[model samples]
Target: MLSLICFQSLITLSQIWLLAVMSILWIIWKSRNDVKFNNFVISVQRAIGTVMAWIREGGLLIKAPMGNSILDVQILHSLHLKGIPRRSTKVIPVFWHPPIADWIKVNTDGLSKGNPSIAASGGGLRNYRGFVKGFFGLRLSIQTAFFVELKGVILEVSFAWEKGWHSL
Candidate 1:
């Protein structure tokens, strides 16, 4: 199946085909697990429906070319499937307001893989004109979200103090 899709000219079409293949594989694996552990019986039609739905949803996350490619349409047609219509995407414009003169604005964020997993904190210092003054990122050992948040602020504050920017 992969060999057939790999020869496609468009990389985007290849990606869509790959996603469909992965979705089918995932549904099969999940059905096998369900039968093994939960003794759940999934019919053929139900499994196909699940794969179709998964492929449809997963395809949406991937950005295709500007318009539909001929290969894309042909592949779907051959499978007796219809491509999911692209959803209307909404664009929201965001503007950043600079701080007052002689003041430094600090922004920080922390993220962890799991709640108590490996974590990292990062932040940046912006001047009144919104130009970046300094930035820092630290990779910490196992830590919680809350701890990382506070650590980010502490690190940024210490950075600002060291830079002699007291007015934040």
Candidate 2:
């Protein structure tokens, strides 16, 4: 369990770092363009602050998906050379919860051929006790993966409603 948690933490931190790096690079590119074309000169202090702000914003965005702002903040805090500049949050763990009694969960997936050959959509409904309520799989016309996914969801919902499984 500890190893799994550590691995997850590392993955989350790496994702945040990658986002921060991308954001910083974009800011740098924009700053360079302004300096070259518009003759806009940004002070070093301002540049540093801008980078920090972007990093913080990236961390905050990752917080939602990681479901642990404290871990992200701690990683961000360690990135700072001096004292922690920002990003302090109470520890919290957020994990998926099973559907309540009498509720069913619908999981869907879609696939598409890269060569515009065919598309497929599939999904299944599971009750709170992890029993399969229903499932569907179908081949669709050549379409984008997004459309295939949407079709899968629509099929699942329709199936559930038709079967009188409305409390999903």
Candidate 3:
């Protein structure tokens, strides 16, 4: 019975050694062949690497931009605190994005009579020189705000290209 137990232990040790060697060989082969992993796995690895790289380089707060835009955002916050009237109380902050102040701020207002005084739809686009180039005002009812915003952006971009503005 002792010999049988010894034999079982030897078998187990051999199996473990075999697994170790096989894994080493597999790793070596994978390295030599440059094995391609599943796309999802590769994507996840890239995202993780990017996050790790970002952390290693610098944290978000440190890497954040220090520019006039930041000052403007701060001023806007201050204005809100001081109860100052400003254009459009709500804001959607898009950081690390290109500025429309340099591009073209397309101001828009609309009035439709069916529900309210949205009868006057007014939209204007600014050129690269920050001058008005194009204006669009559509008087319509039952239109989603999403649609108007999208159209405004499209018009702005279109005019920018038309006026030979380079998109960086």
**Models, CA RMSD each:** 13.1, 13.7, 26.6
TM-score of 2: 0.41
Candidate 1, 44-162: lDDT as tens digits: 99988887777666666655442254656676565554555445568899987889999999999999878999999999999998899999899999999999999999999999999
Best by lDDT: 1
**What lDDT tens digits, residue by residue, belong to model 2 across residues 1-168?**
224343444555676668778877887898899999999988878877887777766655554333244555555567552222334568899864568999989989999866455899999998988888888899899888888889999999999999999988
Clashes of 2: 0
Query: How far off is residue 53 in model 2, in Å?
Result: 66
Worst 10 residues of 2 by lDDT: 79-88
Clashes of each: 0, 0, 4
Q: Give Cα distance to truth, residue 81, candidate 2, Å.
A: 55
Q: Report every candidate's CA lDDT.
A: 0.79, 0.74, 0.46
**Greater-TM-score candidate between 1 and 3:** 1
Residue-level lDDT tens digits of model 3 in 60-116:
223222222333335324323211222344788874332455565556654443443
When 1 and 2 are scored with TM-score, the better candidate is 1
